[model samples]
Target: MLTALGLLPLALLGGWSLHAAGDYKEREQERWMLDLARALSSAADAELDGTVATLTTLGSTPALQNGDLPALYAAASTLARAQPDWLGVILTDDSGKILFRTMDSYGAPQTAAPADPDSLNQVLSTHQPVAGRIARGPRGRAAFPVRVPITDAKGKLYTLTAVILPDRMVRLIERQQVPTDAIIAIRDGARATVARSRDQKGRVADAPSKSLVELMRAGPEGIGTAVTTEGQQVATAYTTLSRYGWAVIVGRPTDKLRAAAFERMGVYGIGIALSLLGCFLLASLLANRIVRTIEALQQGAAALGSGAPLTLAPSSIIEIENIGKALEQAEHQRNAQERERAQLLDSLNRALASHQTALADAREAGRAKDEFLAVLGHELRNPLSPIVTSLDLMDFRDEPGNRRERGVMRRQVQHLRRLVDDLLDVSRITSGKLQIDATPVNLADVVRHAVTTSSGQQISMSTPAAVWVMGDGSRLTQVLNNLLSNAERFGSSATQVTLTVDATHARLVVSDNGIGMSEELMARVFEPFQQAPQSLARRTGGLGLGLAIVRKIVELHHGEVTVYSAGAGTGSRFEVTLPLSAAPAPEPCAIAAPHVEGLQLLLVDDNVDAAGAGAALLELLGHEVRVAHNAAEALDAVRQKMPQVAILDIGLPDMDGYALAAAIRHQAGDTPLRLVALTGYGQKEDITRAYEADFDLHLTKPATVADLQRATAPLT
Candidate 1:
C-alpha cells in the first residue's frame, strides 16, 4: 500500500509540471504581441507629431502675417508638394472658415471655404493645438486634420489646419519595427481601420472580431486572447496613441502555441511512461528500486539549470553513477574557466589604469615644460633688449676707435640671440605651435638680403633677375643664415657656397672642404640636437639645432633641404631647393624718412636703461623725445602735453601697454594718438592682444632705427 501511494504521487507531479510548461509558453507569445502593438503605436504618434510640427513652423512665416495671399499660397503649395503625406495646408479664420488652401486654383477665392467644425472649436476653445478625428472631406475624402492656433499681433487668434492623408499614414505603420508576420492596423474612434500594414483591412468591425476592440477598450493599453469572426483564435493587443479615441492594434496567430503544446505533451508523456515502466519492472525484480535514483537525477538537473549547487545521493545504478560523475567534472571545469576569465579581466583593468596614469603624467610634464619655456623666453628677452638697444645707441656716438670692439659685442649678442631663438623654435616645433607668414617672394632678393645680414664670405652665384617663390622672407633668410653659419663653423677657408636657379627650382648649395660627415651623422643630421660626433659636439659651441631649424623652415615653405658627403674629411655638400613661381611678387614702395624735428614722441617704459637709451637715440635722430619710467609719469606727461606718438613698452610696472593704450584713448578721445606697442612679447598671440587693446602698430623689442623712423615718419 505504501509503494502504490508513492508511485501515484510521482505520476501526478510529472503531469502537473507538463501543464505548467504549456501555460508559460502561451504567456510568452502574448507578451511579445503586446510589446509589438506598443511599438507600432509609438511610431504612429511620432509621425503625426512631426507632421503637425512642420505645419506649425510654416504658419509662423512672415508671408502669412503680411497678408501676402499669393506668397502664402506659393509657400503652402511648395510644402504640400514636397511631402507626399501632406494633402494640403489651410488657413482658417476664428469662425473656422477656410481663408486659403494650398489645393485651391491659383488666384482663387480666399473666403467662404469650409473647415472641420470640431477641430475649430477644440483649437479656439482650448487655445491649444489639437489633433482631431479622421473625417471625410466634401468629396468623401479620408484625411486627419491637425489644428494649430496662431495669435496675431493684436491678439486675434487664427487657425492653421494641416490635412494628412490616411493612405500615406499606412506607410509609416508598415515600416514599423515589429514582427514580419505581425498584422498592424490603425483604427479611428468608431473602430474603423484607416491604415494597415497589409492591403486587406477595414474596420475593427471588419477585423473579423468586435472582441478585439472591446478587449482594447478595456484600458489605454491592453493585451488579450481573442476570437476572430473567422473562428480562429489569436493573441491581440492594442495601445492608445492620443487623447482622441484611436488605437494601434496588432494580432498574431494563437494556434501555433496550441500545436506546440500538444507536441510537447506527447514527448513528456512518453518519457514519464517509460519511467513508470522502468520503476515497475525494477520493483518487480528488485522492490522499491530506481525511484530515488530517478528523483536524484531530476533534482540535480533542475539545480544545474538554475545555476545552483547540486547534491546527489549515491546510486547503485552504473548509468546514473557515470552521469553524476560526468556532471561533477563539467562543473569543475566551468569553475576553473570562470576563475581564469576573472583573473584575465583583472589584469586588463590594471593595465588600462596604468596606461591612463602614465598618459596623465606625460601630459602634465609637457604642460610644465611649455610654461617653463615661455617664462624663460620672457626673462632672457628682457635683459637682451637693453643690450641690443645700447648697441644701436653706439651707432650715433663717436666711437670709431672702438669700432672692432663694438662689432665683436654685436656679433656675440647676435649669436646668443640665435641660440635662445633656436631653443624656443625647437620647443614650438615640437609642440606644433610655429606660425609662419608666407607670401610670393623673389629668391634672389632674399639671398642678397640674407648675405647682407650675415657675415658670409663671397658666395659664388649666377644672375637670375627674379627667381620667384612663395615663402616667408625673414624666415627664409634665417634658413640661409643658419646654413652659412654652419658651413663657416665646420669648414676651412677653402670652403665654397653657391646659389643657382633652374627652370623649376631655385637651389642654394653650401659645399665645405672641412671635416665631412660619417654615415651615422649624415643619417641623423636633421634630427634635433644631433651633432657630427662627441668630439664635434664639444668643439662646436651649439646645441646642434641649426640644421633642424633649417629643415623645418624649408618644409614650411614647401621646399626641400638635403645633404651629401663622402667619408669623414672628404668634403660635404648641403643643398636647399625651393619651387619657383611664375608671377612676380610686388614690393612695397619705400617711404622717405621724415624730418625728425617735425616729430614729437612719447616713450613710456619702466626699464630705465631701455627708456633712456631709446629716447636718446630718437632725440639724436632729430626727434623731440619725452621719456617716462612709469604709467603715472607717462599719463601726467600726456595730460600736460599730448605727444603725437607714444612708444609704450608692454611690460610696464603699474599698467600694461594695452591698458595704457585704452587709458590714453580715453584721455584724448578721438584725437588719433598713434599708439605703438614695443615689447618682448613678440608671439602671434601677443601681437593680436596688442591690436585688440587699440594699438595702431605692434613692434617687437630691439627695433631698428629704420622701423621706428618708418612708423613715426608717417604720423608726422
Candidate 2:
C-alpha cells in the first residue's frame, strides 16, 4: 500500500506534464496557422488596392465626353497599362454607360451596362461609393463590380466606375489551422458556412451556430469546444476579419491530449511495476539469507549428532552474523570435546595394542606346542611305519581262511600309521615347513584319484573335467582323501560326498546325512585332536587331525574352508575353495624314484644305523655311495674324493647338515655336485637354508627310498 501510495503523485505529475506540453504544442500550431492566414490576407489587400486606384483614375478622365471613342478607349488602355495589378480599367459618363473601356488580357470587357438599366442607374443615382466581393457573372450580366462615383469641378458626382474582385478572400479562409477529424468553419449571420477547413459533411455536430455569428459581429476572436461528427472532442477558435465582416476558425481534436495522458499513464505503470518487482526481489533475497543461515545451523547440528565434522552458520545480515558468531563458539567447544574423545580413544587403543601383543605371543607359544607334539608324533611314526609294514607282510603271508588275528593286527597297525601321519602333518604345518610341490593339475583328475583311494561307500564327483589349479598334486589328493575319509567315518559309510571345481576355485563339499555335529562342536571341528562326541568316538575311531590337516593344507594354498550344518542330526557341509593357478608346475616327479643308473651318491647321518642303511640302499640302486657321520668328516671326504653327490644330515655331531654342505661346496672348488639335505627338521626355513648352502634337494626324514634315489639322479 505504501509503494502504491508513493507512486500516485509521480503518475499524476507525469500526466499533467504531458497535458501541458500537448496544450502548448496545440497553441503553437494554431498561432502558426493564424500567421499564415494573415500573410495571405496581406497579399490580397495589396492586389485590391492597386485595382481600385487604376479604376478611379480611369473614371475621372476627360475622355468620357469626347466624340472620339477610340481615343477615349486608348486613354483607358493607357491607365490600365500603368497599373498591371488591375484586371482592367473602365471610363463612364454621368449616365453610367461604358463610354470608354480597356478589355482584359482575355478580351472580355471589364464593365458592361447591366441588362437592367436601373441596376446602373441605381448605383449612379445613390452617388456614393459601393464596394463588395465580385465574381464574373452570366453573359449579358453586369461585369464584376466595385463601383466608385466621379465628381466634376463643382464637387457633384458625374460618373460611376465598376471593378471585379477575384476569389482571394475565399482562398485565404481555406488555408486555416485544423486537426485531423476536426472541423474549422466560418459562417455568416444566417449560420451558413462562408468558408470551411473541410467539406460541410465533416463539420462538428455540436458546433456553435450563434458563436460564429457573434465572432464576426461582436468580437475580434473567440474560442469554443465541441464534439465532432466523428464523435471526438475538439477545440475550435475563431478570429474575425473586422474590415470584411469575416471570421477565421482553427480547430484541433482533443484525442491528442488523451493520447498523451494514456502514454504517460503507461510509462508510470511500467515504472511502478518494476519498482514493486525490485522490492519483492530484495525481500526474497533477504528472506533466503535468513533461511540459508538457519539451514546451515540445522545442518551443523545434524553433523554433530551423526559424529561428522560441524561448520559454523553462514552470516549475511546482523542477526545471522550474531548467530554465526554463537555457532562458531559452539563449534570451538565441539572441537575441544572431540579432542577429549580422541585422547580417550588413543588411550584405549594403546591398552588394546598391549593386550593384543601379549595374546599374539601366547598364540605363538601354543602353536609351538602343537608343532612340538606334531614332531614327536613324526618321531613316533618312524618306528611305527616298519612295525605296521611288517604286520601287513605277516597278514599277507597268512592265508585268507587262516590267521584272523594277523588280519586284525594289520588293520590296527594301519590305523596307527594314519594317526601318526596326521600328527606329523600338523607339526610340519605349525612349524611352517609344510612344503608344497605345486603343479598345473587338472583338479578333476585329483578328485577322481582321491575318490578312488578313499573307502567311502558313496562319493559323487561334480567338478568340471578341465578346471586346472596349481598345487602339490599329491598334497591336494591327500587333502581330498582326508575329507572323504572323515565323511565316511563320521557320517556313516552310506553318506554321499561331493567335489566341485570352477574356473576360479575348486570346492570339496563333503556332506554327511548321518549324525552331524552341533553348532558348538562344528565351530571347533577343525581344531586338532577334536572330535564330535565321546559316543561317536568309537564309531569314528581316530585322532581328529584329518579335518585339521585339511584346513591347514587349504590355508597353505591360500583357500578358505567353512562348515555348514542345520544342527546335530541334520547333516553338515564342508566347503573348500582353492584358487586356480595360471600355470602349474610338475608334481611328485621325484616321489616315485630315489635313483637313476650309475648316479654317484653320498650318505650322511649322525646315527650309524641310518647312515649304513641309507648307503646300502643307494648301493642297491646301483650307485656309488660314500658315507660320512658328521659335517667335518663330510667336508674332508669332499676335498679328497670330490664326489658328485652329498647327502648331509642336520643332526651331525660337529656341524649341521646345511653347514656341512656349504663347507663341502667351498672345498670342492665349485664342482657341479648334486647335494641333498636329509634332515628330520623339515621346516620351510630349513629347506631355504639348505638351498642357501647350495644343496640341490631337501628331503625330510622318512622320505621314501624312492625319493632319495631320485634326488641323486644325474642332471643330464
Candidate 3:
C-alpha cells in the first residue's frame, strides 16, 4: 500500500495532461470551423460587390449614349466574354423594353433579346440595384440578376441588367482554400443555391439543407452541430450576406474533428504510458523490500496472537522494533480497553435518558398549543354568527342609515373572520392537516372577487384573456386579497398591483409606494407573527400571519412568492408565480333554476338567534320553514314531515351534527333528503367528517342568503 501511494500521483498527472491536450484540440477544431465560415462569407460578398460595381461603370458607357446600337452591342458582347462574371447583358429603356441581348442558343452572344422582359422594371423605378429572383441565365444554368440604373450625358435614365451565372460563381468559390471534407454553400435571397463547392450530381438550383435553413431563419450568425444533407453529423457556422439577404453556411464533418482529437490523444498517450511504466518499475522494487519486512512482522504477530512468547528475529527498522514492543505489552492494552468499554456504555445511557426527556417535553408542548388554538377558534367564530345574521336583517329594513351602518358592520365581521381563518390555517398547516382542492380556475375572476371585498384601495386590473391554474379558486382569491390588502395598508394603493399570465406561468405583482420594509424585516416577512415596525399614526396592528399564510397556500399549489424592497420608506414589490393550466376551468354543471315558490325546509342550529333569523329569512323567501335549536329537536321536527332540505349545524347540545346527519339518514331509509351541513367548525377534518355522515354539501357559518338558498334548493 505504501509503495502504491508513492507512485499514484505520477499516474494521475499523466492522465490529467492527456485530458488537457484532448480539450485543446477540440477547441481548435471549433475555432477552425468558425474561421472557415467567415472567410467564405467575405469572399462571396466581395464577388457580388465586384460584379455590381463593374456593371454600374458599364451602364455609363458612351457607346450607348451616342445612339450607336451596333457599336454598343459589340462592346457589351466583348465585356461578357472577357470578364466571365457576366453571363449576358440586356440593355433596357426606362419603359422596360429590352433592346439588346448577349447570350443565345448555346450561351453564345446574340443580337435578339430573350422572350422574358421582366427583370428591369424594379431598377427603373427605384433607381437602385435590386437583387432579382434566381432564374435560368444565359449559360443554361442558375444565375442572379444584378441590375443597376444609370443616366448618360443626355440625363435619360437607362437600366442595365447583368446576370451573374453559376459558372462565374464557381470561379470565385474555387479561389477559396477550404478543406476537401468541408462544405461551403452560398444561397441567394430566395434560398436557391448560387454555388455549392461540394455539390453532388444533378440539380443546379437546389435549396440548402434543412439544418442550415433553420439556423439562418433563427439568427444572422451562429455556430452549431447538426446533421448534414448526407446525414453526416458536422459542426457548422452560418452568416447572412450583408449586401443582400442571402445566407452562407460552412460545415466540417464531426468525424474529422474526432480524428484530429484522437491524433492529439495518441501523442499524449505515449508520454503517459512511458511514465506509468517507470512508476510501476519503482513500485515493484519498493514492494519487494516491504514484502520481506511484512512477512517477518506477520510471523511475530501470529506468535503473540496465539498467546505464545513475544520473541522474533530483530530488525534494524525502528517501526518494526516499536511493533515488537507493543506486542509484549498486549496484556496491559486489554485491561485498558475493558475500562474504556464500561465508561462508554455509561455515557451512552445518560445521553439516551436526556434525549427521551427532551422529546417528551416537546411533544407535550405541541399538544397543549394545538388544544388551545382549537378552543380559541371555536369560541371566536361562535359569536360571529349573530353579527352576520343581524346585518342581513338590517338590509331587510332598508333605511339609508341602517344600510350604511350595516355595511361598516359587515366589513368588521369579515376582518374578524379573516383573522380567525388565518390562525386556524397556520395551526392546521403546521399539523399537516390542511388540504387544498386543486381544479382549473380562471385567475381574473378570482382577483375580481377579492377586489370587491376591499375598502380604501384603488385597484386597476390588466388581464389577457383567461389565465387558468390548478388550485382552489376560493383559496387563490384569498391569496390575492391578502397581497392587495397589504399593499393598500402599507403600500401606496391597489393601482400599483398588476397581475399577468404568460403561456405557462401566472404572475401576480403588487408594488407599494408607501412605507417599505427594512432588509431585516423583509428577511422574515413570511415567518408567522413577524410584523413591521410602525409609528403611532401608521399603526395597523395585525397578527402578521398574512404573508405567511399566503406562502403556505401558494406552495400547496406548486407556486412561490418573492418580495423585493429598496429599504424602509422606499416602497416594495411582491410577486407570485404559479404554473399555468392548459385549459380553462370547467364550469359547474348547470342545475335548472329552482322555482321561486315556497318549499319544505328545516333550519337547525344551537344558537337561538341564528336559527330564528335564518328561519325568518327563509319564510320571506316563500318557504315553509321549520326551526330547531338542537339535534333532538331537529330530528323530531323532521319526523313530523320530511322537508325537502335539512340544514343541520355541526355543533349541537345533544350530539354533533355528523351523528345527527347519520341518524336522519338511517331513519328516513328509502327517502332522499338533501342534507346541507352548516357549522363554525369549518376545518378540512370537519368537512370530511360531515361528508362521511352522508351530508351532500358543507357550508361555514355566517353563509350569505344566496348560499343558503342554493343549498336549500335541491338540484333537479
TM-score for all predictions?
0.47, 0.41, 0.47
lDDT of 3: 0.76
lDDT of each: 0.77, 0.64, 0.76
Tens digits of per-residue lDDT for model 1, 38-146: 7766766777678768877877778777666578778888998998877888887787767778888766776564555766797889987776667666776678777
Pairs of colliding residues, candidate 1? 208-229
**Higher-TM-score candidate among 1 and 2?**
1
Ranking by lDDT: 1, 3, 2
Candidate 2 lDDT, tens digit per residue, 309-398?
767644657776776566557757855997889999999999887997889999998878896786687577345533543443444345
Task: Please estimate how well model 1 matches the true structure, expressed as its whole-model Cα lDDT.
Answer: 0.77
Give the clash total for candidate 3: 1
Q: Using lDDT as the measure, name the better of candidate 1 and candidate 2.
A: 1
lDDT tens digits, residues 73-145, model 3? 7877888888766777777777776667776422335455533344466577778776665666454666778
